[model samples]
Target: MTRKLTTLLLAATMLLGAVSASHAVDFKIKGVWNMNFEYGSGGNFTERGRSVNGNKAAHVTGWGRYGEDQFEAKSRVRLQLDAVASESLSGTVYFEIGGVTWGRSSKGGALGADGSNVVKIKHSYLDWVVPQTNVKVRMGIQRVFLPDFTTEASQAFDADVAGIVASAPINDNLSLSAFWVRPYNDNWAGDTQSPQNYLDNFDIFGLSAPVRLDGVNVTPWAMLGMFGSNTFRKGDDFYGKNSTGAGALGLAPAVYALKDSKVGRQLADAYSTVLWAGITGEVVKFDPFRVAASFNYGAVDTGVEALNRKGWYSALLAEYKLDWGTPGIYGWYSSGDDDNIKNGSERMPNVEANNESTNAMSSFGTLGTWTLGRDTLIGSTFAGTWGVGARVKDVSFFDKLKQTFHVNILGGTNSPSMAKYIKGAKGVDGHTSFTPDTGTGSADFNSANYYGLYLTSQDYAAEFGVTTTYQIYDNLRMLVEANYIALWLDQSRGVWGGYTATDGSRVGGNSTTDAWNVNVSFIYKF
Candidate 1:
């Protein structure tokens, strides 16, 4: 991705399509398939839960690591295509693959990389529309905008050649949304190719960028109206460092000869920058008060900051949705960027110049772009599904029994030095991307901090379900539903391990260090 980074991403997508332009572009490019054709029978969940593999401040320096019972998938298939979008312009082709005759899976959660059957091209792009004020913008190799709902995990999943966006709506209250991304932070879907690689820092916050088939993102934005986004760039790409673990380097081996030097990827291990701006609408509507805020100065290494590497970082976030019940209550906060004595200041590293004397937080910080579980929140949770992974009849596999207790999920643990134990991160043995505190944990069921990160959640997320019947015959009935989640941590990571304990006799966590992930899925709906 170099041709001057592809001409500064097409001059930042035509200067954001010359700003404030949008009108006629009806929009509709269909064909997005989702398949899960199940038959019957199920059983698996030993380490099935806290798979906490890597990313999310992996494991501060013992470099994060995870490997257990993997090789599963009963039935699945997916296909993507746009085949249509109406005026101005649009195009598509998104590939998909699952199951394996060649990609074969004995069973654990199957997809295939060597189990055979793995195909990719995920997305391609093209878009244009600027005649009035409808803001129809679309740029190449896209999709990297952390819009709510913790999808499979976080750590500020980065992505690039990017730009996620919106603009157009001055009347329904307000309008505008954003992304100026720069990802390629390696992982490409993980589980293969390891021999000491190390490229993952164009920071797109929290991993996972799959929205190809020619890029295009839209969000006319409304409600009191205010939105802002920023993704930065500087260069050098050694990417955050937790150092020490698996092939240990633990700082001082002259930091691997300055990452094998050439002024460490040009002028001391360069990472980049992004700045965000915000203002959201709807400040009083019957029972509403919606607002958003952003103030940023950039320098990112993904998932909050992961040890600053090169230099500088800054951030802020806000949310207030009060109307009570249904969908309300979401709080946010962000602030990163600490490192002065800039531009080639003493050749970077050294825990990124000791994170400029500590404010301690940025193992992929948290708040929007959701770094990594600062409380994996879910709003008023409830769930359902059945056959074909059924999405509702009672949620997830037609139910015969169920239970509830207002839900919200995602667990906690991160913040020790900056997590990220190990796995891919540009081919393993890179000793994780730092941030300590057992590099985030879960798979057991503990720390739920008022329910989030991972206490228990299903039915999309943030749950509340209840099913009870005991008919026995006729059509048949006999069920039990009892699922409750509320695990928590940040009891202040045992209050900063007794302030970096010298021996006040705190010995930092491990009564199995509180981890959580609830389970209860029993079914038979006929």
Candidate 2:
């Protein structure tokens, strides 16, 4: 499948190139392939799917896979429009072919258990840029990212065929971007490869109103965003229907009618019209000395009552470069309980059971890395989090040798993704109980007032690591890293699936799941 997709894409590119060459020929190509060799397998890294960035521990993988090592390659090529000649319009036509045990934000990066492998046209989208107006409009299939969606974050999916995106620079230092995108109309809209992601992909347009400011230093910008729902929710699609329906996935006709309420249509429309805004600024900046802040509030806009959760999230990031190593620190915190859910008395009702309801509505992506010898290592951690992490790095060693240390004593109370662990008594379903996933009825919030169990928010554990990468050649590099994490989950610290978690710590678990991790990766960029 991957080869065919690759061949088809390459052939298509060639054909297009030939056609354009003969006629208007406004097309150009851009491509990049990132390949990796990884070792130390135990952890969620290999199980859930492929980690494009080579992230080591996500619940998707368990602990034992950490020590395992292997190598793989992934890449994408794009056909672009020469801004000078074809005006400012461009689109990408590419595919991926490779094998890896790590999973990424999308199913394309999944690690197959059979090791048979995967290769296909992961994504392709087009964009139109207006250099003069500093405005770029991109439509077709595209990637959509949200503010606080942690894990593969963004409580959403891949691009939509009818999606639209526009980004324009308001001034020298500030710019704004807005997009109306989705991957599914309801549940059964397209390919069923990643049912959870694809079906759950929605029919919505998220708009980010314009905001401008000067520079990242003390500059303030305001942003307003609106999300418009699509036909998938109109009961004609496969996903938005009730779970019991024999159809693909449509809502119950009666419910869709809203019990004959005067505001049925309006309420439904408003539910889809989730609104959110934020103010951000970077006040301090002196080389490594940097300070930035932001506050965002938005309704869940799931188009469902109660599930139409509201949120307020904020963060403060600052950096300071030092001699030993560059020391950096930052943290973010947001309230997930802002959802009122229409008086909180509503039961999980009939609505399509596609994928929308399962979203974590989180923020942050994942950091990818690798390791070398046991104590010595190299890795990269870039996914966003609730902030509260600091680091110091020194790259003066052996030219390629870099000695560094970091501390991420950060944790959030309610994370859609499994950042923290499940502590205390297990729910009826083996999994520790929580809201959204299990609904509000399972675990009591502030009732007994316990960390992982009682709804009381949890604090972040202190996570720190030292890593280094050496350039073996201009296009290839070797990396290794070692990390030490002390989680604050006294009774039920954090739960890392792969390692050895006696209590809550494992291979690197605090009590049961905590243990030192050694990783390594060889990377070649083409």
Candidate 3:
């Protein structure tokens, strides 16, 4: 961190402390802490190796020989302080610390190195209710535009921004909200060699309506965003059409040629829009069945005329209560683009973008439920895929502990499109080619360069898991989980198991692997 940031943090802390000491305000402190360890095994492939003749070198991108038989330690803590001036007004200061490391740390009590653990202010916001009405306003740094599950689990949508949010109740069962946010700001920075890079910013606007029904609840929301950055600034006529008059002669030309030129700035803007609707309801009364569904659509300009930037995803789930536990089933689908959009090649102008948008669902952190197929087959529903899952929760033989079990089977909805996106080819070309990239170990499982984008020739995949939680105390718990996945690939498509060389050479041993993991966690809440 820079000195300026340190000073700002100190000032903010002092301000909060002063508020807490004031007679007009009452404050409360609360937090959650979690510590966990994970172990992974199986599925080890060479990242790169020479062919038998030594004339060809092949690179493979899939499960590599890393992260197997290794133990990982991860921990996180959230601290929050809320100061209330009145029932209608309050302010919050929230801090977070989290990190992951391979193996146990040797340091017994001292801080390890910079970035070994992350500590920062996660939220600082003020909430005020308008007198004589149910209108509330929240302003400052906070969370916005994420799903309920995402917010609760602190997973996919765990992003905070500086913004202002206004919400009003239309009636006892309906409410509306609007917000404007700056997700990224360059206002705080030290002198730099290239100041032009710091001139970019991101702005987001959103509106939502939540309605409550007799047996159901629904929330519909929409968001609009604009990203302005110097990343796209380049030579004249290079970014877009250069319609800003590079043709004009004289002093105007000189002005336009500068690094901070108006022409360059205007060309660095991108726009995107999102729409989502979600529903939760009691489907059956006597037997106690519940259902949930979410639908999402997104469009982006990407500032690239030849690239497609539109996609949609949807998920459905139903649960039933039994004498021993609750059982549920779920299915989801995401759209995909045609193979015409080749990898490493220029797409047609106005190409139809696939529904491969990132983090469309809350996968890993959803409490009491596991998105089995979603987590094992793919990181997200991007790139057009579908799957079905079944889960049972709260199978208890004892009062302090309960077990949950889940199984899932996943398949590609658009195999051709998946091939194109994963292996960067189409039809015969893609089928005959191997991916030229690096594989991942257990540690890099979901990274963008690894499993996030490595679903090449997967004909199908299945996953199963069991989790148990023990209540050590009212506010403390211990959890243990074991998971396994079996992935199958179409060998005819030379894109399985290992990577394809840049020149279309293929290398690898097997096309399938049974990967497994075990996790243990301790959590405390106050």
Candidate 4:
């Protein structure tokens, strides 16, 4: 009798353990892999090896120098894991590896393939619904993009940062969302006089309301930020030294002030305030025809007149869907500087991702080769410029093959005279005295090195591109893309021509050659 009882108890305990195990969280994994081959030329439009005042300036080259390599190859991989516990709770962690160039010894793309540290945590967040309520909250590091309908890319703010986002639905057609993000903190190690961690935090708060009606959707949003005095100080680990700090925000004017010893003393005890607002909407009342538009305005006040910045940006997109493809036209414009240095810049301020290869346009690079070509050569924000483009998207003639064609014309809105104030500005006598103390460095402000080509009223460019894709399998695809850009620069005294050599000579004569690139890619997802 005793032996039988003991056996029964053991069986009961085993069954209970099994039941608990079945109720535990479930894990799911998904990932993507991409490989690419590319060849291109003409990233630098400036004339190299010019002589200034009997002094021959060394031949300076820019990124993607005006030439070509046989061919370059690269690869990237991303994996995401999710832990789900019922419908009310879940957690996600996304990891990324590579985007490493082939044959790069540092990244372990060499023969041995033993890279030191190539893995990164792109995102890690937890989602949970309020107990007995419908409100949902996400907390952790994640992608944060502002509302944008026209280009599907926000011009003012779009990047990954640590924050808390909360959303609640008011009705079937309306919802509210809010977030608080901290982009920089504790980056400044206080000096001997100041205490550790003193006023070195940058924070942003934002809110948006999304509305949906019959065939109409719109969202209105606003954001406010507090920038500490020492948030971007020299020796800061978050952004590097003052000269190169805050580049992602396109805050060149402010950064220049912080870098200059004379100007830095004036803002020693001052902080800054930033504000932005925008509206994005789409009209799809007509089934096959749709229209989208967006307008945004932003401003930054650093308590100093020369460091303030304010401007606006607007864009429109219209498309018609056909049986075989979709055709669309798009345009955008943003305010630009007016050759004034003391009053600050009038161009729109924005936050861009540090990785230039990842900044792409939804209307342009329909495939993954957006960054592999010339799409963002004029800066991802499109500030200080205006453009018009047309595209035929997803044209299909075969079962699993599709193609797209694109053309765009771009022009600058900034005053041509502004060139004389930029860094490296040379006079007819080949003297650099024309350069201003506040906005001297081209790489410091909205220059070619930091952003893309900083165009003036006399500068323009035209772009043409083609993208073709073949679906090889349910989870794999191959793509080929080609892009070309024709550039024209005004070589007059008021434009780039003002930068003359010691003998009053302009290198490259009246014009420079164009730029082009071709890319091939294979992508797999599961």
Candidate 5:
């Protein structure tokens, strides 16, 4: 009787162990490393101010003036870990290291390679599905992007931020998603006398409905935000000095309006409101032929009439797939500021990953690839500009080799009269420089300039690019890219040429040379 009882106890213990093993969590890892070498020239377009001796000096461009080494090497690494218990629950963490430039001592790229504090947490989030329901929820710091079809990247908002997102399928053809994101909070250590956290939060709420049917897919989304007046105050580290936050959101016009209206001085002002709406869709019912389009509108109201902004943007794309490659044509247009700065700006506001970072509009450069690149010399956003381009993507003639070619023509939508309002403009040989505004205690208008080149109706540019890729192995690849741009600026007295020195002489020259860049990169994935 005792032996029989012991055998039963052993069987019960083994059964419990089997049940526990069934619930064990699985761990997975994935990562990528990229190394690159690049060279380029001619980003600066305007000439430096006239010399003291009254002789025209060599034109100074931003690249040359700032001592940007045209030729340099850089590398980046990213690692991601995921823990999964089942199809219903999971967690993820992503880390990034480097983009470290060779010979940069600060990032530990120097001789000893002892870079301090180089690792960054890019993403950390949890995902789970509700019991007995189709609802899915994600929380924590994660990537957030507004739906976009034409450009393949959100022009209004796309980045990583602390947020909560939930989604559910209502039917076979319809689904819904909603999110709440906090882009900034508590970064401001208020005045010594004021409370530490007074009016220092910027939050956004958004919703999107996706519809799918018969080779058709579309998403309509809307977002609303409550922006604290003091959210980007002067003393704060990241958002202060207009470095990030507002600047990263392409809100230069709003910043300019606030400073212009003098409303920013009043500490009593608590909050401003922002709203955006957009729709994007794609139709592949034609099979080999595809069409996609996107339209967006945004507005910001700060109570003061002179501190309001509203604008619209639209884009279209058409492509046909072939055995060897896909040929496509795309175009975009966005509203720009009128001649009156007092009426605020008409340019559409957006939230991009970084200042002047590339979007999918230019596929050969910047954000289009898994690895990042320098954006076009002209500008990165569709705001205040219009453009049309053609491309052949994924043209492959050999095994493990592919290539893409692109050509784009760009023009400005802003008024030429607005250029005259720019203050603290100065020219430095080999670069661009701005003089400080000592009188207003206000930020320099030049400092709020968002677009690298503030093109007006009189200015235009042409760009060409090509990218080649070769798979070196299952988890490794090599890439080579080349790009060129030609710019035409109106040098008339009514336009960019109107600037003059104290001596009433033209400050910069009338002509600018074209710019070009070449890049070689190796990428490994695991």
Candidate 6:
């Protein structure tokens, strides 16, 4: 089935390309393939998964469990087709074949685990340039936006959704873009037991305008997003009326209705609205200096009758080029949850789950570096955290070999106090716990908490690391990195236990006080 689908898609795409080319319209086909090799000292360097919060032990586990010398390889391929239909219209089809695992399958075969590979249509859209106007409309599945600079240290605002985007050039120096985006709606609308019940119907709208001034460009943007099914909420009563008519005996109709309300309320509280503004520009057109900065603030209105959700983030980056290389520095700060789900005057939810205040740093494939320090120390900058780093690029001794070097230091405190949220937990040895009222009972509030189970670790922890990449060719490179981290688990002692502390002083449970890691990656791109 997989092979047949791949053949059919490729055949159809090729046929379209041939026919479109014969029409005299511009048609182009391009692709990129990257082969990656990874080796890590504790085997932890190659671990893959979304970050789990508050799990200090999970973060500290050395990859040695995988093996003393761990090595893994993977490949990715992307194909893009561009066809210009007319003077004012064109279309694009971009597909990405990902998760093509290599080596032995789960059953010990050479191919891979059963059905472990998958393909995705990352972007497929039609572009229509309105006649006699500067407006253009793009409709279909597409990326939210691709920034001109880089998403190395922050990517919290990026998303790919099926939607429509419109852009208008107000003048030669100014332009505006807006988007109304959402993913496909699900079919389990009336199925109470389906996991789809908890999935919200996400509606997102965004507007941004860029103003170019001489050598500098400024973009002011705002996004309004909501998740909930106006349809599902209304169908609550309908389903409730038919309980047991066509559904399983244990799955009551009210369960579906309640799930809708609970999921909607949680999502609303998780990320109600987001507003941010930013500017990007060069210091001198003739010189190699550039800067970009942005600030974002938002709130989660859980409407849970007890909790409040709110968080904000800010970041800045600057770079300069000299005779040898380009040097850059970046820093960011994001609010963390200062209080667990407390009630009354204490109901504070900084950087709430739905608030979307996390900062997206670079990733392995996206930025060519694994977040060793970030993952070990703070999991992700999306929670309450701050960090600064310096990077130098393109240092070359010979024309064929160039190097890029980076060093970053980061710190963070736990958000939402996982201990307070969970039962049967006493305070960490160093931190204080809050027992404020939880007010009304909403569906566990677990939906609003992304942090993991109670783990011993300090609130104020620090991590630092250095990484270097040697580019053997323009499209081929080798990367290596080493990281060190020390967590401040003892908030009471004013310092998390240092290398000398024992489990008695750690929070939640026995957590590592200090950890070290090393990793290397060989990449080839075409």
Instruction: Tell me the whole-model lDDT of each prediction, alpha carbons only.
Output: 0.25, 0.38, 0.48, 0.66, 0.69, 0.46
TM-score of each: 0.23, 0.58, 0.70, 0.83, 0.85, 0.69
Task: Count residue pairs with overlapping backbones in model 2.
Answer: 97
What is the per-residue lDDT of model 2 for residues 1-526, given as tens digits with 9 covering 90 to 100?
3555566667766767676667754555444444443333221222212221112222233332232333322332323222223657656644545433345424245554223334545456666776667688876654554432121222112222456778776676556667665434444343332232232334444544333333333322222333233334333332122222211211112122122232222224422433445555564435557566656554434444622434455666666666655555666654533112122111111112112111111111122231122211111111112446665656454766666556655554443123232222222223223221121122122111110111113434445566667878876676666555443433333332233333553322222233345555565554
Say which candidate scores most in lDDT.
Answer: 5
Model 4, CA-based lDDT? 0.66
Q: Model 4 — which ten-residue stretch has the worst lDDT?
A: 49-58
Residue 492, candidate 4: alpha-carbon lDDT: 70
User: Which segments of model 5 are wrong by more than 4 Å?
Assistant: 1-23, 45-67, 235-244, 254-261, 264-269, 353-360, 364-368, 423-448, 498-506, 509-513
Which of 1 and 3 is ahead in lDDT? Answer: 3
Residue 428 miss distance in model 3 (angstroms): 14
lDDT of 5 by residue, 1-526 (tens): 2343345347545644654587676767798999988787665422211111111132343233223467767888887877777999998878777767778776657876666556677899999999999999999999888878888777788878899999999999999999999998987677864577778788999999999999999999999987776676665322222444665466545333334223434333478788999999999999899999999999877666455678889999999999999999999998988877556679887776322223555743224545644453554457788999999989998999999898999888988766544432332222222322222232133333343566788888888888899999999999998888777877775665535654555454233556777888999999
RMSD of each: 24.4, 10.9, 9.8, 8.8, 9.4, 9.1
Ordered by lDDT, highest first, the candidates read 5, 4, 3, 6, 2, 1
lDDT digits (tens) for residues 455-508 of candidate 1:
111112222223333444444344333222222223233222212322232323
Could you tell which candidate, 4 or 6, scores higher by TM-score?
4
Quickly count the clashes in candidate 4: 1
Clash counts for all predictions: 106, 97, 5, 1, 2, 19
| Candidate No. with top TM-score | 5
Ten-residue stretch with the least lDDT total in model 6:
245-254
Candidate 2, residue 192: CA error in Å?
Answer: 22
- How would you encode candidate 4's per-residue C-alpha lDDT over 232-254 as one tens digit per residue? 66642222223324554665452
Candidate ordering by TM-score (highest first): 5, 4, 3, 6, 2, 1
Cα RMSD for predicted model 6: 9.1
